[model samples]
Target: MPERRPTRSLPETLRTLRALRTPADPGFWRSPVRGARFTAVLGVVLLVGLTLLFVTGLLSYAAYNPDLNPVNDKTPGKGWLGFYLFSWPTGPHWLYRLTQGLHVTVGIVLVPVLLAKLWSVIPRLFALPPARSVGHALERLSLLLLIGGALFQFVTGLLNIQLDYLFPGSFYTLHFYGAWVFLAGFVTHTVLKTPQAVRVLRQGIPRGEGGTRRGESGTPRGESGPPRRGTDTLAAPDPLPATLSRRGALAMVGAGSLLLLITSAGRSFDGPLRRIALLTPRGGTDPGPGPNAFQVNKTASAVRITPADTGENWRLTVRGPAGELRFSRAELLAMEQHSAELPIACVEGWSTSDQRWRGVRLADLAALAGYPDRPPGVFVESLQRGGSFRKAALRDNQVRDGRSLLALEVNGAPLSPDHGYPARIIVPAAPGVLNTKWVETLTFGEL
Candidate 1:
């Protein structure tokens, strides 16, 4: 502006701007370990790992029975994302436990591998001529989505595991929408790159050299010395002397995965094994010793549940087509008592081993509510004054299951105050929140 230089046309100005930002020099990247083979290996691992993560993640959402809407569904206006959702089954008892445990534990274990994979292909991110053609432009866009999506999903999932919610808006909605966006890019990238990756893995670099041969100008070359060009930006033309071999790098990544697995997998188990899950939130916690001693997501005090709130005056209200009825703690205990050994699994992926839970059957309560046979869906309410799941709705199958109970005791002892002293709903294969601790009311009907 001070010099009053000659004005340039829009095309010329755009070209000049592009040149200013372009990293056109091939010698810029100096990593010998960055190559087709290394990236391909890491890509294959993510292919399998990410597919499992996605499937299990969807299953976790479905297990919530979001069809109940407003009560269980956190992500409103999900549209097509809700297509795969179905009625969660109430069998095998440990279905949610196994699936969610794998989801979190595997995600933790893959962190190192994912990082290494990103590192291996970092050169591509800064490749000059951002888009050479229409197809290339689309490919670049997909790559951006893939990288960004991967980071967002992993970061949010880890924060969730740690019980941190620093991100704005509901975690459920953000994560669900983010997953779809990521999946779109992921599927596109996978389709386009799978063939090339497979070919590279099977064929190896030309002349079986683990590293690429560079020409004088720091450009990669094939056997005949032609400038090897295309989408393989990972080939660093002027690689530095290798400090770590490719195989050694892969071994290091695998070792990291193993360490994470060792430290995070134990959160799903009971007894001594649970102590080893130091990387997880509830891993190191000591709930003290007793029949009731086990992991708890929240204490009674944390939920603002006081002893006075669950005092003898507390009455469980049951409502149905016939009418309404009420019962005291003694009356519920006197009713035909049922017992079941079921594990309470949380969405965060922590769970307890099967504990002896004794209580009145939910179906029996439905009988007292008038729908004696084939109990319809029941909307259970908790005494908790405030929380996300103060009330939850159970599907008809869950209500009809003989194993489902309005639990009164645990491990042959009365439930502790923090463990829903007066009463709690305990259903097989149900999320821990649906167990509805400190239960106060049961409304039986179509929900």
Candidate 2:
């Protein structure tokens, strides 16, 4: 009675397994381009890329800590309802600059790998359930979130970096919130799938190797190492696809990522790479008046303000606790001038090399305007009438720091019109928007 073990013929068993998959999903299983090896290859690339992006992105977020960031933001100061309680390091002035650059560059380059990974697994979307259990359902749900969240982060982030505001609503808040949701889904999926990925990879080429001979355990490694009861599925199908090989697919994804990294890296790259980064919009050799001459986000002509407005009669009017203190261009230049090297960073993630900026200190202006020696806050108003950031409020640190300036010159030359002309606010560790240009007024006090 114990000798009754039986099995199907070899060809019959192969036929049954071939028919075991789903009807609704695309048949990637049938394609030469799809298999565990190909899927695992692209998956590893995407996994690493996405992990880096998330870490760097969170670091960038920390850099904007209300206590550390010079911009007077309302949210972080309150500590996200007391949940996220951490401070960004104030050391290494270039830290945020480097992290954000890496975040954006990694994101752009990883696009190809993400797409290929999705393509390889598209059939699983249609796979008939091997079993209909709660665990299976949960895995599927996580997959949905992973795909959706990854696409959201990549699409929205790229558009923002390019300065294209086609999407409505606040990109900053939406993107930040989206990142948390994405990270949750990614962790869940990784936990459930990584063992299988590692096993498939360990089994060698698609044909399987070592202990994974014919009739070896089809069951995963951590499970009881038995030949999976009824399923003697081969450890692999075919090592190379009939059409595109795994090597070819990996090469394409890698090439795409490299191209993206080079073009979008901008002046954040130095050495010889900076010269060859053809897609970089921030240039060190550009002829203008701001740092590296100038890197114009929005030009004066585009904003439609006349040169006369910023010309000889231009005056910076400071309304303080005492009264209004006004200064003409020559008068500000005549004051004790201080110069500092500061990098102007944009929320879009591109940052300039620190430039030699010379001007009067903002704290000095506050003092001259009869405010307390160090006001807790400063409000900057630009001559440009209509723009979202025509006005900006500065944090306590920015107002107190001597490096903060009403800069009149860059390097040795006065600012060009596009570079904010007669003067512009230049502050340490502040967003470019807070450095309001075409100066008109300054008010130092409560926000």
Candidate 3:
């Protein structure tokens, strides 16, 4: 500065800045396990697990019937993203439960593998001469998206499961969009690197080559050579003594995944097995010792639904082409009563075991609304004062299902206030939210 040294150009300044960083020197990353073979094993596992996670996540969105718009659809301006969406089916009664459960459980289990995969290739992130060409620049950009998207998805998903709504905006919208972005980067990276990864896997880790010896740049002992390039970037230029072998590292990651699986999978089941899912939210708890004892996502108080609101004054409104008919809780109970054991599964990946639900069939209600033969879509509205899913629109398949009910009692007991006392909607294979509690109105129409 004293001599007014010539100002360096932007590119030159960036190069110098990169040179000073510890990561810029391959020797700074002294882990012997950071190599192509190690990375390939982790990558293959992620490729399979992440693919399943994505499909199941998309299926969960579809289960919400997002195409209904302003009703259950949270993501606005989805455009072509909704192209592949189909009318969510209403069969097997546990479809949504299984899909959403897999989505969440697999995502949680893959965390350790994802971390290991990143660790094996982190040196590539700080390679000198950041962009060797336009193609290289594109590669780096994709990598950035891949890492960022993955972290964002996992963090948001975990927060949702914990019922922590710290993030601004709707979780459904954010998660839906984030999934697409992650998929793009994932597809690109997979295409670009699959061949190399396959080749590395085919040729397993070399024997007796645990790591680059200390003070060596991946060259044979007694020889001084230039640092490695390309795929060899993961090889430390000047490594430290090996503390853990590559196979040992892989085994550790597998064990971690297995542990998470054991602790999370039980949330989808009932009885004694469910007690083992210590890591899952709402797991291992005895809600109470009674006929209606089970999980409840939101109590009447939590949703600002007061006792008076669901008292004798409350009436179920059924509207359609025929006419508008209203019924009191007693009137609904007087009508033909049906019973179905359906599990209530939530998007947060929690599910209650099948509970005995007794109520009038939705199809019967639709008939009162004039659509007796083929029940049109029904928009079920809740009496809750606040919260999303106050209203939800069910597709024709769901409404026509014999098991769909406007439930009056659960487990042979009149519903408690927290369990949607006056009335609630319970449909097989539908998400818990769609089973609108404290149901106020049912409008049958084309939509």
Q: What are the per-residue Cα lDDT tens digits for candidate 2 across 109-145? A: 7888899888877656665553256766776787778
* Model 1 TM-score on a 0 to 1 scale: 0.89
lDDT, candidate 1, 198-218, per-residue tens: 767997653322234422222
Q: Which one wins by TM-score: 2 or 3?
A: 3
**Clash pairs, model 3 backbone:** none
After the best TM-score superposition of candidate 1, give how far the Cα of residue 131 lies from its true spot, in angstroms.
0.8
Alpha-carbon shift of residue 154 in model 2 (angstroms): 1.2
Q: Which candidate achieves the best TM-score against the true structure?
A: 1
Candidate 2 runs further than 4 Å off: 1-28, 59-91, 198-244, 267-275, 280-292, 370-375
- Is candidate 1 or 2 superior in lDDT? 1
Tens digit of lDDT per residue, candidate 3, span 1-447? 378777899999899887674876776788777876888889999999999998999899889888875688888689999888888888889899889988998998999999999888888787777876687788789877899999889989999999898877788888889989999999988886676567567765322233334533322221122434223445676667889888999999999999999888888877676789888887877477787778887888989999789887999999999889999999999999999999989888878788999999999999999987999889988889888889899988988999999999999999888888899999999988999999998999987
lDDT of 1: 0.84
Q: State how far residue 424 of model 2 sits from its true place (Å).
A: 1.0
Q: What is the TM-score of each predicted model, taking all chains together?
A: 0.89, 0.77, 0.89
Stretches of candidate 1 off by over 4 Å are: 1-24, 206-233
| Ranking according to lDDT, highest score first | 3, 1, 2
